[model samples]
Target chain A: MSGFLDILYFIVPISIAYAAPLIFTAIGGVFSERSGVINIGLEGLMVMGAFVGIVFNLFFVDTFGDWTPWVSILVAMLVSAIFSLMHAVASISFRADQVVSGVAINLLGIAIALFSVKMIYGKGQTDFIQEKIPRFNIPFLQDIPVIGPMFFKSVYGSSILAVAIAILAWFIIFKTPFGLRLRSVGEHPMAADTMGIKVNRIRYIAVIISGGLAGMGGAVYAQTMTNDFGHATINGQGFMALAAMIFGKWHPIGAMGAALFFGFAQALAISSSGIPFMQNVPSVFLYILPYALTIIALAGFIGKANGPKALGDPYIKGSR
Target chain B: MSNRLINVLVPVISIILGLLVGAVVMLVSGYDPIAGYIALWNGIFGDSYAIGETIRQISPYILAGLAVAFAFRTGLFNIGVEGQLIVGWFAAAYVGMAFELPKIIHLPLALLAAAAAGAIWGLIPGLLKATLKVHEVIVTIMMNYIALHLVNALIKVVAKGGFKTDKIQDTASLRSDFLSELTDFSTLHYGIFVALFMVFIMWFILERMKLGYELKSVGFNENAAQYAGMSVKKNIVMAMVISGAFAGLGGAMEALGTFGNMSTRAGFTGIGFDGIAVALLGANTPLGVVFGASLFGSLKYGANNMPNAANIPIEIVSIVIALIIFFVACGYIIRVGLQRIGKNKEAK
Candidate 1:
């Protein structure tokens, strides 16, 4: 009975662990698109972050020992932020087709990361880490019945941080003056410019923050969940996050809710055996669920979801 | 004179700016940008083998670029080229495995199957857009995922314990050992010839045919074309189908000529997405596509090879490509810079 209880305890926290990466990434997506730059390159940025995270963690684990995960997190943020600058320079400064530029960034990120992995390991996969993100039991709250064990015991601590960050993101996006200025820039850049808000600076800040958050998400994923980097590590997570952002109608809390739903779907896919004939369905269906759902969500079946008014439109100073 | 100079100089300036940014990144990482660039240059063009390999790599891009450029000309973003390529590959490979005939008959049959499959794959999004009034971008992106999963599942089911199809029959295979022999066993194949032929055909169709003109007109302004008695929906559908056909041919060549067999694990090679870059860089022209494909192909091939010779990561090349596209897309900076350079030259 105790063993069964323990097993039950793992379900929600593990699901939350899976949800962390998507939550952070989707929040990142919200920041970038809200500033009118569509970051299709999130996948690429995540991949780059994953690779550099693992590479840094691999080297620093012996030196920093248990703190390796923290170091890796910082490394990922820097790499991903640097990578996002390419998009900013292209889409914001250069005023390129945001979609095409995003595609280019995706290709660039994948190619570089894959090529480097090939060079380091002499193959596609990276070396497994000795020190990964350590799992922890939350101090007093872990003793609570049923839900406590699932949420606080044997859970990846990074997921808890993700939830806190999501709330913080909401505060930044809605409650603050800076957030208002940023939203104003996204809704009407010309009007914001006339009101003396630095449109370019806000965009730069948004894209950079987007990249940093996404980079941290990738690092968290590698260190906590997979504990290693490989060619397919980032896979479709970035796109899934994008879908979540859209499905949530670009709201941070809404995006988090969508991400958690996706995480539950993923967890359910593994745990539910009596889902009728779905037991016989291939795993690829689960793999494609978020993307498929995104399409359905975008089809207007979910009602008219609003996007940032200036989304995908390059800001011209005087243009109406 | 200034405009003429700027047209030639913009791409050059983009490339230079891209390289400069790449250099800073390299420097930050404690690597010599000069050494890395030289190695990349040598890897891409140092020898006959490298040149042949680059050309071979460019072959698929030529077709994919044309596919994208065609759709773009009609003002339709056929993002489903990735899916079209996958289905076309499966169809062509299935035909190649199923048939046994004289090489002359079998090859054309296989190629036709690929083209038809691509067109049909393309038609789904077209039909949806035409009938349901859905956006092509969303449909096409969805189709990419669907095609990827479907192909993977199909491969697992059909392989019957194998990961790939039975080796394609000799008659259906587009082996290029003859061309390889002429090039001293370099990777270059007869696919280059095929790509060139397709380019010529694309040019002839777009520039000389009334159907092509109608398609272009529809793309430029659907309402105007509708007023001129052109069927906007039909042209949009046809444009997607034709564009998908080109992408399908790209898959056929890659499978038959390069790999000589189809693996289920190989779905969309991402060349379709890259085709967007090629089309943009090429200005959506058939001949321009060849040059764009060659440049990007070399970058891809070179970037792949760079990590081996230099410590720099291959992703640096992608960063450079993105920067180049950004500069091209903006055009404003390049335009101002060129005018300044021209004014200075006149002063001199």
Candidate 2:
């Protein structure tokens, strides 16, 4: 029992760090998809965010020092919003296939990042980031016995911000006029249009917002998990976030919970050797456990779940 | 414009625009676009060796493209082709090593093993899509990561941390010394013939067969096909299985002909993802996929040498590919532009 407590102490903090990015990106998916535009380009958008965030941090770290991470997140978000406009125009305005457009963005995002790195350094890689986001514990709460040390110790600001943002997102989606219009567009665009709501306009904004949040998610992963931006920095974290969104039934709070579950699985996989008995499991099995779980989880959602009714269909005016 | 002209012109225009944007990116980065393109051309077509390499590269692309195109014709999106291809790749390699049969028997047997393996992998998602109505796009993407990691684990177990497996027996190998000599010592093999044969099969099935007509009708309208007494569920599963067979052939070509060995991959080969673009570019036809696959193959083959020759990033080739696909997706915009020009001509 003592041994198990020690393992939990290590796993809890690490899982939250992993969960922060997934939660943010999953929330983005909920927004775009709930607005009737499925943003499969989250992976690409996240990569861009990771790239810009690190590059911006490197450029300004000397001048801004420790405060660079927060500013870089904002920069990445802005850049990502602009980058996703291409998807918005292609899918919504030019009437392109949403999946195809998303794939295009994915390809472009990675290529552009790689090409820029090559152009800047005349090589396939960039320099590693030296300054990282600082971890902190709550002041007096740190003295509180078991719950404090397990949860609040060595915490990332990004994780706390993620929970807050999720709460804010839940409120915006469930309790606000803007979210009502957004849901209406996703459910029935013609019905929403007749009621003086602009479907295309809402979709464009929703996609941009999704892009911005996913970018920040990428930034968070780079800052906390990898501490560097490279080809492999983001890996498949964005797709995992998408799986969380689906698993959560497109609800913000639900997605956050799903993200936490995936993060715990990931933390378990990486740290299994440190815990007794788990060392017997093959490392390869652990590596694949999260992805296999994601597939099973999505399959589980099949009978009960329904995505936005107008999802994947472009809105056309006066075409009842 | 005639339908045939539009069909040809759309891809041509898309390619030109893709190249133009690639050139602009190069210029903005202070590189000479003309020099880079010249290097690209020379890298792919300058010598018999380059030509052979390009054709060698084209082999798997053709089959993968067909896999995607075939599924599209059945109104099913089969993004799981990557997973199927990897499973087939490993299956072919496994059979080649495990068996000790006659040359003729072993080669065909390995290829069959690959196709069967891919077909089974594809069947899972197809059943889910048909019965549960779960989207293939999400299912396949998740499956892809699972396939990669599973293969990685298996390869480690089989090879005992070797990271790469040994070359297959000579009987299972597709490499032909005669074909390589004919191409002046390049990696070209008999896989090209096999790929072309598959294309011919695709064309014959879709254009000439009874079952092909039913598949096409089903693809065009699922409800209509159902009302007309066709089994949508059966057709969906069949389409995915057949599509997986083609992607499996692509994997076999890579395992037997090109590499002749299996190695742990860091990520997907990107051949399957690129196949989606190839299918769209080909207008989802076998003959069109041939054209798209060839173009893509040449670009990829050339990209390997572009960085050394012109001081340009090899990623430019992929950027060009993405741009081409984007332009194809936005084909309507170009069509509208052309229609406006035609109207002005009429006004004049």
Candidate 3:
């Protein structure tokens, strides 16, 4: 019992910290995918967000002081949302292949961000920011028994915010009238169109919201984990989030759960050295666990993942 | 204009627009676009050495492009091309290092090993897509990460915990001393011939074979193909395997021709991702992929000179490449714009 508790105390906080970014990003994916647009550009949007977040934090640390990370996240969100408009214009307005457009967006995001970094810093990477997101235990919550030590200690505020947002996303996606209209557009745009729900407009909103949330996720990752942005900073995290979204079957709460599972896998990989039996295990196995599990989950071990009926098909106003 | 003319015109116009946007970006960044283009040109065609190296770089790209184009022709997206290439690279290097035989047997054996490795990687996702109805995109994406980690681990085991494996024996090398001498000591090799041959092979399979017809029918309409007594699952798996074999051969070009060894990568080589752009620019055609590969290969090879010659970052080339793909993706807009231009010409 004591050994299990010790492991929990060691692993839980790290898992939550890792999961926070994935939760935000996966929820972002849920929003876009649920609206019938496959936003594979989430990776690119995250890259943009991470780049802007680090740049903003580095430049404005003197101005914003302790609030620098938060402010940078907001700015990153706005910039990333605007950046995602290119994807929207290409795929939605111009009727480009969504997957191809997303691929272009990924390449463009990394290229433009890295180019700007070199131009500004006169180097391949930027200076690390001093003001990182703070970690603290909730005052009263820390007094609770076994749970407090495992869950409340050294917790990032972003993790709590992520969980809150997931719940809020769940409410907004499933309970609201707007949610019904969004699903209707994704499921049967023609029916939704007849009922006067401006399908394209709803899709545009969903994509923008996804961008904003994914940007926030990127910013949070840069601030809390990496504390700097480089080419490798947001590597594959966006794809992992995509996996989480899929594993969760495109549901908000389910995505959060999947994110947590992936986060646990990541945490185990990082913290395996501390555990006795795991010390001898190959690190590569741990590294491959989350991805391998995703494949398994999608391979009908869990259940069939049926996406929106109209998913990946562009709506052409009146065309069948 | 004829439909065929419009099809060619769209890609051409997109390329021009892409370059124009790149020039505008250079101007915005306070750099000389003319000097950049000049440096870019010199980098690719300044001398025999540059030309040789550029073609060497293009060899793998041609195969990668073909890999993607073949899959696209079969209604599949093999995003795991990078992962397949990695495993193929390792397999070729391993076979090359482990063997001691005549050149003919050794080289073919190494190349076959690479193709098999890549095929297995692709087959897993294909099987899942066919049997379990899992989305290939997601499975391929996962497979990529798995391949990276698994290959890296295997490399360590082979190299005794080092980052790279031992260099392959001379018998298996694709490098040609005669070609290198002709190209002013550039790393040009026999891989270019192999790449071109594979291009022809892909064309033959897709255009002249019954299997190709079956695959195309499956891609075009799975239900219709099934109704017509085709095995949709088998075609899907076969298409992925063939696509993977092409990608794997791309890895052999790097292993046997250019590098002669396999090393653990810090990230993806970007070759497979760039293959997406190449396929798109090529309009997913065999001959078109050759043109796309040449353009992309030269630009990529040329990007090295931009930082020194124009005081610009090399990433600008990547930006240009990305923009080109973006324009290609938005071909509908270009078609509309061209139609408008044609109408204006008529009015005048």
| The candidate that achieves the highest DockQ relative to the unseen native structure | 3
Residue B151 in model 2: shift from native, Å? 0.5
Candidate 2: lDDT of A290?
61
Model 1 regions lying over 4 Å from their true place:
A1-14, A62-65, A114-125, A138-146, A149-152, A265-278, B1-5, B16-52, B124-139, B186-188, B222-232, B264-268, B299-323, B343-348
**lDDT tens per residue, model 3, B1-348:** 557888899989888989999999999999999999999999899999999999999998998898888888889988888888888888999999988999989999999999999999989999999998888888888898999989989999999999999999999999999999999999999999999999999989989999999988998999999999999999999999998999999999999999999998868888888888888889889999999999999999988889998888999999999999999999998888878888898899
Selected candidate, larger DockQ, 2 vs 3: 3
- Candidate 1 lDDT by residue in tens digits, A235-262: 6677778878888888899899989888
What shift in Å separates residue A16 of candidate 2 from its native position after superposition?
Answer: 1.4
Q: Rank the candidates by DockQ, best first.
A: 3, 2, 1
In candidate 1, the residue pairs with backbone N, CA or C atoms under 3 Å apart (3 or more residues apart, or in different chains) clash, namely A112-B315
Candidates 2 and 3 compared: the better one by lDDT is 3
- Structural similarity to truth (TM-score) of each candidate: 0.88, 0.97, 0.98
The list of candidate 2 runs beyond 4 A from truth reads A300-303
**Residue A307's lDDT in candidate 3:** 85
Interface root-mean-square deviation of model 1 in angstroms is 3.4
Question: Could you tell me the C-alpha RMSD of candidate 3 in Å?
Answer: 1.4
Index of the highest-lDDT prediction: 3
Interface root mean square deviation for model 2, in Å?
1.4
Model 1 per-residue lDDT tens digits across residues B1-348? 457667667766776887898788778667788889988898788877787778888988898999999989998888778888887777778788878989999988988888898888788778767765666775677777777777777666667757777767888876777767766677677777888898998898899999899989998899999999999999889988999899888888776777766776533487888787778778788987988898888987877667778867776787677666666666666777678877898999
lDDT for B270 in candidate 1 is 76
